[model samples]
Target: MSHAFDLALCALILGAAVLAVTGRNVFGAIVFYVVYGVLLALAWLILGAVDVALAEAAIGAGVTGVLLIGAWQGLADAGGLEDEAPRPVFLRLAAVAGAGALGGLIALAVISLPGGDGLTLAVVDNQDRLELGNPVNAVLLGFRAYDTLLETLVLTAALAAVWSLTRTRVWGGVPGPGHVTRPDGVMASFGRLLPPAGLLVAVYLVWVGADAPGGAFQAGTVLAAVWILIVLSGLQDEPRLNSLPLRLMIIAGPAVFLGAGLAGAAAGAVMGYPDGHAKSVILVIEYALTLSIAATLALLIAGPARRAP
Candidate 1:
């Protein structure tokens, strides 16, 4: 029964992947990609890696799905879709050959490989001294915080790039609020309910990450949703470069993470994300990252909010 289920899941994944890559409609492709991700998550659960499964689902299906849909929406009205030509037959054949060759090489390498990935295993072996309940989160915050810090930079840069390409900030190209509505009416009431509710989910994910299946990135993404909702509803001005608080949060995570790494040398370690202060370092980094992500996302949706004339 389990084998049959796995086979079924694999078939579904393959179908989704094919449709995602081959669909003529960009939106359909994005939707298929999200479906592929969900199936991949189920596969991971069957493989006994719940945490990894969660990350894949959250980042792949949830975050990336949102990003792609927004991008498609922005591009939909541009009329460029009408201009694209189908690939030449030779070109399509060459692409298929190249992909098959690459897959074959990968399989060959796996068959010949004789060793295992070791860094995490080493961390787990010495985790008693690490004081981290979640070995994976500990490694992220303690041993590889530099990578996380740099990743946040990449996200910021990507947002900026998207802003540049679209000629506006928001990927979905949503127009600024059309008209002001009652602040005390239905929309405002819904907004009030979401803040606390979303914050609770975010905090729970962060705190439980120490021992369970959640962590900083997941929590940050969840928190960003709240900011996005408020911005979308036009209850607040789409915050712009004028917002000092938002600016600070935008840059704080990398500053704190880099500072901690440089400071670690004084204690004895010469690298960032050292073992001695992993949890504290991770918590601080996570909080900064969360703020930065939320602010960036909100600003992206707000696009450019010009000064009032």
Candidate 2:
């Protein structure tokens, strides 16, 4: 691509991002956010980063749009947080310039960074014996599984805090009422179909991450979005806790991850997942985490998780 083309596209993306962030109209902002993301994804593709483009498009443009709309819809149902007037034009212009300068400096720094050592490559080369293709996922879920494990804990903790604060009296609340307004003109038909399709894609991303540019976390987020949608849509109600299934689902991921880790340690290595069982274990752990996260987030959003009984 021509240099001018790249610069023009980047400008368009930055412009859209600015609008997304500063637009007074929530609906307009979300539309801009999606546009910004697609532009950013295109910029990455133009720069010869196809893998990054894939993720940016999937997570940034697609998932982020859904999430923002969901949150906005929730906010609207809750009467929205309050609105403020737009800034003066001069102030807005100054703000834009300052942001652009900051962005430029960061880009320069990136361009100037020195080449790094092959630390990651070295680990993958030495540990390729596991027959795992994507070292990054293995590293994220295996060697560093502890980090991912704790991340899940943090997610749960945040959810718990929200649930405690909300303290809903029932599954008693009307469906999507008092806090679940769908955006104007955003139909349920497409919304209903999108999650399942997105889910299939998420599974593919997870499976492909074993050999390509995807993984559990990415897949989890997408899958989680589907769950969030289903909950938000009232397809399947959020499971009330203390129930057998709920409790089991909550602990499922962490238990399996730690148990597998312990088994590996008992055999010989710390955090070692069975020599050839790594793939199986990783998928198992990922699935468990997804379920746990979905449940946790739903409960957090709903508050005082109610039993389906």
Candidate 3:
């Protein structure tokens, strides 16, 4: 049964991918892409990668779908949603050949790879040192802390790049378009009711991440989604990039992580936790990261500054 289910899912995923790529309308393509992400998340779950599933569902499906929808809406508003010139038949054929070749190469690579425990045993053996119940969390926040730190920095840098695209007159201004909502609308009601529940879920995910599949990235995505809903429903206005509190929230994660690394250096190695305090230090970093990541992702989806500060 499981094998049959897996085969069916693979078929669905392939169909969704094809539709996402070839759909005539941008909106339809975005919707199909979201379906592809959701199916991909399910595939990850079936492969016993719950952490990857969570990240896929949150970032790939949820956040990316919202971002694409926003972009499509913007294009529509600007009268840029009209169909573009079609590619020449030869160019289209070349693209198909290139895509097929790439797919074949990927399949070959996967087939040639040796399958083994591959880091699981090593991570389990060293998990005690990090005091994290979740081996994935231990690897992310402990053994591979530098990589995670770099990823956070990359997200911040991406936000900086987005801000750089702002007009000179609107530099350091508010991010995202102004939203006005009818007070009695479903969106307004959802904006009022959902955030409180979302906040609890976000906090719980971050707190439980030390021992489970949940983590900073998934929790941060949820938090960002809630904020986006609030802004979109007109429950709150987008914050100016120059706002002191907003700026602090955006940098809190990286700043704290860097500080922890420096403090770790004083203990003999960078990003090293002091003996008997690994969990405590990691939790602190996770909380800070959750805040920063949430803010950064929300702003990224919101796009560059528009209104004046």
Candidate 1 lDDT, 51-146, residue by residue in tens: 778778877787788877866765766775665567888998998899999999999987787678646578888665556788777667766766
Question: 183-218, model 3: which lDDT tens digit per residue?
Answer: 999999999999999999999999999999998999
Q: Model 2 — TM-score against the truth?
A: 0.70
Report how far off residue 118 is in candidate 1 (Å).
4.2
Model 2, residue 118: displacement in angstroms? 4.6
* Best model number under TM-score: 3
Per-residue lDDT for 104-180 in model 2, tens only? Answer: 99999877776674356676774565556776665678667789888778867776555454335543232223224
Against the unseen true structure, what C-alpha lDDT does each candidate score? Answer: 0.72, 0.70, 0.93
| Number of clashing residue pairs, candidate 2 | 1
Q: For every candidate structure, what is the RMSD over all alpha carbons to the true structure, in angstroms?
A: 3.8, 5.3, 1.8
Given candidate 3, what's the lDDT at residue 240? 89
Candidate 3 error regions (>4 Å): 93-115
Name the candidate, 2 or 3, with the larger TM-score value. Answer: 3
State candidate 3's TM-score: 0.93
The residue-level lDDT of candidate 3 at 6 comes to 93
For residue 52, what is the lDDT in candidate 1?
79
Lowest-scoring 10 consecutive residues by lDDT in candidate 3?
80-89
